[model samples]
Target chain A: MTDLVKESSTQILAREMALTEQSVERRRRIVGLEPDDLARIAGIREVVLAQVDHFASVFFDYLSGIEEGRVLTNNRALTERARELKRSHLIAMVGGDYGRAYAEQRLELAVLYGRVGLELRVFIAAFHRLLRSIGEAVMKSTPQAPLEAFASFMALKKIAFFDIGVIVDAVVFERERVIRQQQDAIRELSTPVLQVRARLLLLPIIGVIDTHRARLITDSLLKAIRANRAKVVVMDVTGVATIDSKVANHLMQTVTAAKLMGASVIVTGLSAEVAQSLVALGIDLTTLNTIGDLQGGMDEAERALGYRVVSMDPRRDGAPLSPG
Target chain B: MPVPVLKQGSVLIASIQAALSDRDLVELRDDLADRVGRHRSRGVVIDVTALDVLDSFATRTIRSIAYTAKLRGAETVVVGIQPEVAFAMVQLGLSLDGIETALDLEEGMALLQAREAERVG
Candidate 1:
């Protein structure tokens, strides 16, 4: 039984070493890492390293040549190198103490490559795979160590990538969406609405309104007012924390646009700071219905729609209307 | 005297902490041009929040900074001109044509950082 155990362990070691060599070779070819350079760094047998390096270079060249005259282009080569580093690290992690040292060394190398602005996505993917393999190997060897560290590292990397990717994609998507929406709104302005409707168009604006967004809002409101043929349009600014001259000018533009479409514009939701800003800017909203809040704006909107506010009378068990 | 500058990442930022006088404006333009010439920086953001009054001279100086900085291979951003100041400048028919304006110092810094990232990435 002891002899059998020794044989199994030896087999595992040999397999892991072979896998590592294969990965290193594959990666070297992709990244243009010379075989001699890798051999010098790894300090392994020259003949073995040379064989691995030659195979890697030939394989990559063949792969590239077969597909589009070069399977591994510059971009693909970087990705492949990152992948190989990760695989080699994973294989090394299976050898207990020796594997741990190998894994650490590989991580250091990956970090160094990161400084050169290499493919971060590829590196991250490789890091994830390495962590997973390490966790699995540790669980099989010393289950008591708890895979918490490895798990957390992998999770954090995943989340960081996901968060950054989402933020970047969101910013790009939102900018494009706003541009498209603005174009649509501007196009709508050119085409007049056939008839008037009873609904009021409410545009609640918040945050610092930049010139670009301000222009878009003005175009959109004007288009909506014309399209809806609404009698009242409420421009709620309650959520707007502050206003500058540009924002105030944009509001004034909206009011003017609404008036041109034969619609009364109601400006509401002014914070103290914004109100002060507007007053300081000396922007005139004399022609526009300036409400303090959404409720007031809503009431005004309802009134414009010919709905009168009636007080509930207990005696009548229903409601009573004041004399008009 | 050496210009007071803050380095955030690869971006070099200068804060113009006082109202712009003719002398101050001249000094600022020279200082900024000199800094850009020396650093070969990714970008430069000038925070002008403390400048209450932006006369035509100041406005011209700001535009010149943008032009000169661009010539020196650095993007220049002018930030934190108050609403009242903006209104005053507009009323005076001042042009902020070439210079980029941010709402505050933080936003200005963020803009410069983004510009640097765009350049490097």
Candidate 2:
């Protein structure tokens, strides 16, 4: 009867070991966890498989948060919340007799989480929570010196996350600032010049001369020439291409507006296609300067000013316009 | 499936190696959009040199392609616009305003190379 009882107990132990092995294998496949290796690292008896399973589940939540892009905003409030959670988990884990083994598993998980695309903000938050939890657990269960050092190491890990988060936030802010500055510059360039020189102002058309930009160009040219008290203004079209009827009409309107302002206007860079298009549309450009190109228009300006283009070192002396 | 034409280059050079019908055009648009987004090429040169005529739809598609490229932080240049087709485009009152066009494949290559050089230097 005593032998029979011994045989039954041995059979029960064998069945339990098989079940534990199966559970570990299943967790490895599902969560990408290597439990046997982690159990060894934790230095807890391999027989205690339940604790490893529990820790793996907790680490998986931290991983999910990182992938979602939410925890990455690097806000101070969010980091504090994450710290609180890690402290609670560590406290619970350290209270158990298997403290060393569990702490090792947590440390390994923390490193892996860092290597993942987890944003520094979220990682810091998770690390702080982890440190707090481990500290509480260690103090409750073990009075050992090594456990205290382990707790200090975890706290150090939290500081590293904080430093990384600051760097990431700074980089993100600077990039946004530069982008805003560029946008502002473009806006300033696009703003129409209300006035030029005392008698005439030049409105050089740049970029794709769409119907909208063409209208803005015409309106601004008219306003500037009038406001500046100029006798003549040049409408340079060197940058313009593929002028349609709408654009040609806008040009005519500029001529009429400048005349109203008591200033004459010059239309330059009449590409062959644009000239043909104007002709096809039956629009007349006979009253305008209608120069062949920008250089010719500049020469006309120089002639009107009684000045000629001469090479001069701008730094030594301002760009000099010699009398024509 | 639209057969992807492979060109010899250190980086993968895949071209739309088939006649573009309406469906083909839509697929090409999506494929190029994906490529531009994923690879972030310096510039994507769409060689329409084989195509002599560009209908309104084709022009519209090219404009869309250019816009998608811009969103992906890459420039799009349409190459091989025959003079006759350009004339027709002007007559049709279609706008190619926001797009850059090259006279031939060589010009396209030169323009892209110059742009890349400017970026590096």
Candidate 3:
């Protein structure tokens, strides 16, 4: 789930957006951000530029009014930074250079917004208030040409829609990145090849086994066998809820691979339900050296490793202890 | 490079110190079979701790070497297949079945000795 270190954040963003110069142009076309629309927005740039501070204050005020939005705007320092970001973003919107760099900058801003726990809908709702104030500013500035002021607002809305699309995508991408990292963490934690004793390894598999996790389990088990010089492995699958053909095949492959590396694997904790399913599924269990449970598997492993567990208390066993 | 084969008592130890080409592997196999007969060795241990990748050709060659040694009355054990290499082998559907294997050279020696004792008993 972790990408290679060589990939830059910009490159990751590009991949996430599936973006190219042509695709960026395509997005502009889809959002109706044509050259005429850009011209109109640029025509009213001075009017909107003068009212940017007003727009930022209006947007921040709307954000501060909501419960979720207050989580971000409540911090004075964060609100100040967000105000600066808002001014620059608004200035760039009327600047009318809707290219790759513009998309990249907007996405970076959206990432910041995401990091501050700002939901897209909250930002969108607050953004509508700022746009409405800007619309009023346009109408008042162009008092003589009422129709042209309305046209400018329509042109501005198209670019705003384009920016919103980019922000929405960036937020989704950030969430996906978080999910991928969490999955990597879970996969690492799920398959633990623990060395239970000298020359003995215990692999307790829990939960469902997907192909990726199964690969990880086998990889770690083999590495532990080599690292610990383990002679026997007791794999307990009590927490594994099902035994499909694919899972059974993965288990068999793991056992065979361990055998090839001089470590014998004793599978344990095949629940009766799963066992019956395996039988019904016609999975050949002969290749698997299975025991009933973890205890039996450990006993068999101890015997294979030439280890005898002698009871220290004399009263616990009927047999007499041998003199050392 | 040609792998060096050392004889310890009736056992031959061949440690592969570098990535071997196909020619080097075949030569090592021939050298081991010859040395086993010349030294009258009863067991052979091929140490592959240095090899990082064991492709299908290498795996097949190793299996072939074990079978050839077995036919000549010397049991062969492959030792020190690295963890990553073993994982790759499994992913590539390569295996060394019917050939004895051990984690390291010492373990390989123990395995060969145990088999020898079993035969004697």
Best by DockQ: 3
Clashes of each: 4, 15, 0
Q: What is the interface RMSD of each candidate, in Å?
A: 12.8, 15.8, 1.1
Higher-lDDT candidate among 1 and 2? 1
lDDT of 2 by residue, A1-324 (tens): 954764454344334233244443442344333334333224322212334344333443564456553432244454343344344444433233222233222332232233333555565565455445434443444457666545443433333333333234333443455687875554345734423334445667654554556556655664454345455576777666667766665566655544433355677788888788878888777766788876676667656645545658666355445333
Residue range with the least summed lDDT across 10 consecutive positions in model 1 chain B: B82-91
Runs off by more than 4 Å, candidate 2: A1-324, B1-19
Query: TM-score of the B chain in model 2?
Result: 0.83
Model 1's TM-score against the true structure: 0.30
* Model 2 lDDT at residue B63: 88
Which residue pairs clash in candidate 3?
Answer: none
RMSD of each: 24.4, 24.8, 8.4
Candidate 1 docking DockQ: 0.02
Per-residue CA lDDT of candidate 3, range B31-50, in tens?
88788788888999999999
Least accurate 10 contiguous residues by lDDT in model 2 chain A? A96-105
After superposition, candidate 1 runs with Cα above 4 Å error: A1-324, B1-3
The CAPRI classification for model 3 reads as: medium
- Candidate 1 per-residue lDDT over residues A1-324, each given as its tens digit: 964764454344334334254553443344343433333323222222323433334433433444332322345656476446534533332222222234224433333243333344443343344334433543444346455434433433332233233223333443465677875664343212223236577777755566666666666665565456455777787766677766776676656545433456788887777677677888765656788887787787777777766667766443534332
DockQ of every candidate structure: 0.02, 0.02, 0.49
lDDT minimum window of 10 residues, candidate 1 chain A: A39-48
Sorted on lDDT, best first, the list reads 3, 1, 2
In order, the TM-score of chain B in each prediction is 0.88, 0.83, 0.97
